[model samples]
Target: MSRNVREAVWSPDREQIRNMKMYRLMEKNGIADYDEFFQRSVGDAAWFWEEVTKDLGLEWFRPYRQVLDRSDGAPWPKWFVEGKINAAHNCLDRFVKDPRARNRLAVIWEGDDGEVRKRTYRELWTEVNAFARGLKQLGVGRGDRIAIYLPMVVENVVAMLAAARIGAIFTPCFSGYGAEAVATRLKDCKAKVLVTADGFLRRGKTIPMKEEADKAADLSPCVEKVVVVRRLNRKDCPLNEERDIDWDVLMSNRKALSAEATDADTPFMIIYTSGTTGRPKGTVHIHSGFPVKAAFDAGYSMDVGVGDTLFWMTDMGWMMGPWMVFGSLMNGATMVLFEGTPDYPEPDRVWMIVDTHGVTHLGVSPTAIRALMKFGDRWLEGHDLDTLRVFGSTGEPWNPEPWSWLFEKVGKKKVPIWNYSGGTEISGGILSSNLMKPIVPCSFNGPMPGMDADVVDEEGHPVRGEVGELVVRQPWVGMTRGFWEDPGRYENTYWSRWPNLWVHGDWVQVDDEGYWFITGRSDDTLKIAGKRLGPAEVESILVDHPSVVEAATIGVPDPDKGEAAVCFTVLKPGVAGDENLKRELVTSVAEKMGKALKPKEIHFVSDLPKTRNGKILRRAIKAAYTGKDAGDLSSLENPGAVEAVQQSSAN
Candidate 1:
């Protein structure tokens, strides 16, 4: 298993090659070549999506008059044209109809304090219904909006499904957000109601949220009601008799509410993903859009079928949170929701969850893998993680060292790491690793089915073996309708680069074998002299050094060269980064990526600033280093990290 998974360890077992939905669909369509099948899928995306839903056995109240209606435009391609559907019905009601589905577990949640909660499909259905009735009682009807700010608890899922059940647009706010961050989203969406918790445990400490919610509600005049879930059973939790209500009081009756048959284009949730500056852009996903895409990616890429357990280390605010829930349940599979940091109480917490519950599919990030690798493989020694048939990765581009470590140590080189790269706007994945394929380290086999993704030069011409912008030439079912209340901005952001293609802002390369590797965000590309390379390319080489735990490379303005690459690295706990070690890190990058692409300066820092979801904030890092404004840093988990980088740069 320790052998390199890039080449030697790609002998997939017979079970791995079995007919899944995509394979069967291709075979049925008389498409023999996988590549040609993808081309045909792009050629007739509408037919392909209709076929996909049919294969998934999805039901709709009113069948679509047209498979797709691009009458509006490509940027706003309407899917399931003139169709009627409800996301919650497909996820909950359909599953609850079958006794086998209802009896199976839907979600298994674990808190940092050893508190565990499990809900079967039947139980989840009842709870969602009860919550829906509660919302109805509170006058939350169709077209109304609600905001949810809670920890990774079962109630969060219930609230989301309830909102979707009643056709109310809901946004899952990151529980760690400050009052301003929460209020901005609430104000933008004009959320009428907010579902939150008193507080949740983190690192054995209670992080209060009631006060923050109270402050945010005050700031957002549109919010009329605030429902507080009494987590930890805090009797003295903050309460506003005029506006705030208890969770139990709201969900008192085990009443049932009928799922609203919403128009296929009805926006179900508004997920706010912060940009480099300005207010966070709320990516509006619809009833049939995000869910279908998520389920398709999970089912096709990881083979997450009924009875399998899927766990993605993510937050409710992040795309993967909703992705895992809708994807797994729609596939009739169970989802694992664990709250708290993966290494807080124990380094083996992630493995423990997989072992305790039979997690057939496990999704993680490269940052998490790098951090875990620092603790050595001893923590993973005694755990039996045989249930992990497939590994999933997202969030950021992977460095080869951590990628190899994950394949070797956790997977034992037996399972494929299903690397997926996409965003909240896309709902699922643009480029994803498939079950029936060979995997090169830190690379994707190709674009996911139904996606006509390609690497294009600045002029929109396809480039081979050279880094370029990742673009989608054809429309897909899961593409975001548009940014909330800013269709013009959405058009400018995605479609303006090319006539109709979606410029995804990612820098990618396609090898001769057609394996795609996402280098980093295109905006994060470093132009050192004449060579254009991504920061991840330089950072990956830096992280390969023994002392470097993780690295963030940024392109700083230079005197001779227009811009030069500079690295800010955090060393392993036991390792020190002296001048000699810094020189070694620089030399390693030079040796790996050629001397022309070498960094102008290499600074060792105590920490690298990152979002709560573990993405390195290069913009924040460059801002702090350059003494420039770091705009809209509410998404940042640690302010101290930025200051540490600034101090290191000064030194």
Candidate 2:
């Protein structure tokens, strides 16, 4: 642990604390202490979630008889039992009911070629209703699955809301995925319909997405219809007369449809997250479960509310993409959906979007920051980001250098970077930074409200001041109901670890000051010379080198030490990756992390495999280097990187 990160750099003033929604929630509960508020939230979850739903103004056709039902078991505890609610209603109908909110912008979309589109709550409601009616016309209804494979656009959001409007479960595939990946999800969900765009632009090139969608639809025999959104307006766009239907034609009926009066526990989404070894796990989310948790985290923790524009650089498939949608709309905030890379056209595109959209809360991945930082601060010159109030980060652990650069340079040391950490199963964040407290660099101040999170040893005993497994003791509202049609795997994956304990698979530590930091995935832990190690520790030290832009570390089998560390690095542009540079990098990590943890080998690569959301695929890299089967690579944004790692090992 770095001593420099021990002291908090940013603290909320009296005025700032008073303005925070977290403070208001605490005040409303008559709790003077923030810590006390968290205690009550986890100690009495039923009371806390009841207040959360009431505070969020979540609409319910029939109120829940109880806040939580745990008789089944800890892993499968039902939330908001007996309540009739609709996700679309909470996101749109409630806002449209108020005249003042009806005219507010619900979604602001920016295309790759400088095209812009905006929709108010009333306008979005009309579009969503039209699509919902169209889905109903296709015989889609409650319990049916609709697969969405479209770029980041207003229509993607509309499709999601439309599916929810009719009580259909929707599964979103990464826009960058190929046919096999998309087909896997479609087949797993056994979707009745597939929504996709003709194509999309990226880095001045038109990617033919329809072809992939067509191939995937062909593979997924259960797909009864294909709805194509004419994004690029291609005259040559092929349409299978038997199965494909134009989006506009499908929406010929512009009549409105009522939001489905769904039971709160009814599954609305089946989001698949890639696992280390099998097919992707389909994490099931419900109407009140994901929406409520996302709303509370955004509204209370991130301080998003009416008039705040929230933009996260992500694809529709990732949890954060859906999280941004439900969280922002549910809070009456505008969601900014951009359809291009952050560095495309210019490295400043991300900053430009923030300035152009008046974004108050901006979220990004640490990998993106590391990639953007290579361009220097010249890209951020003219954009006046005066409207940005908070910076949100997730996806992976942050190295100190990029974290400091984001805080000190981009934020001008004024805005707080809330390091948010969680999985798709958690709906939002397990650990999040609170505006009411001071923040340490790259560290979460505490767990999100109602998360009974703790760091535990191998035996399940709580451990502090050292790295350990991150576990949640009590069931939270956002917990995934279970893996779709695979309850046994879900139970074995999380609950079987230690009775009712949910082992989240991440290595975490709480320092003496009570600040939390995730080291890396517990399964990816590098055991060297009888010492437990985290890949982030080695990667952080390697990235500190000026020549190295990004790095990934993994443990390989060793005859003597049991396991040895191997490093893969992507050097800065124009930097040579000769043996001398590799030696220097190896020495640098050795000097910083002691000689025992020195990388046995360092290989230079152009890029590392990552998810659409920009999380480095360390397990994939290890699998490739070891010539092991890399299972379920559907989430990888760059399959070519795997071959590169494999080639490097052969060298």
lDDT of each: 0.88, 0.92
User: Per-residue alpha-carbon lDDT of model 1 for 462-556, expressed as tens digits?
Assistant: 99988899999889988988989998888988888789889999999887777788888987888888777888878877777777888999999
Give per-residue CA lDDT, model 2, range 438-531, as digits (tens).
9989899978989999999889999998889999989998899899999999999998889989999999988888999888999889889988
Quote each prediction's TM-score: 0.98, 0.99
The Cα RMSD in angstroms, rounded to one decimal, for candidate 2 relative to the true structure is: 1.0
Best by lDDT: 2
lDDT score, candidate 2: 0.92
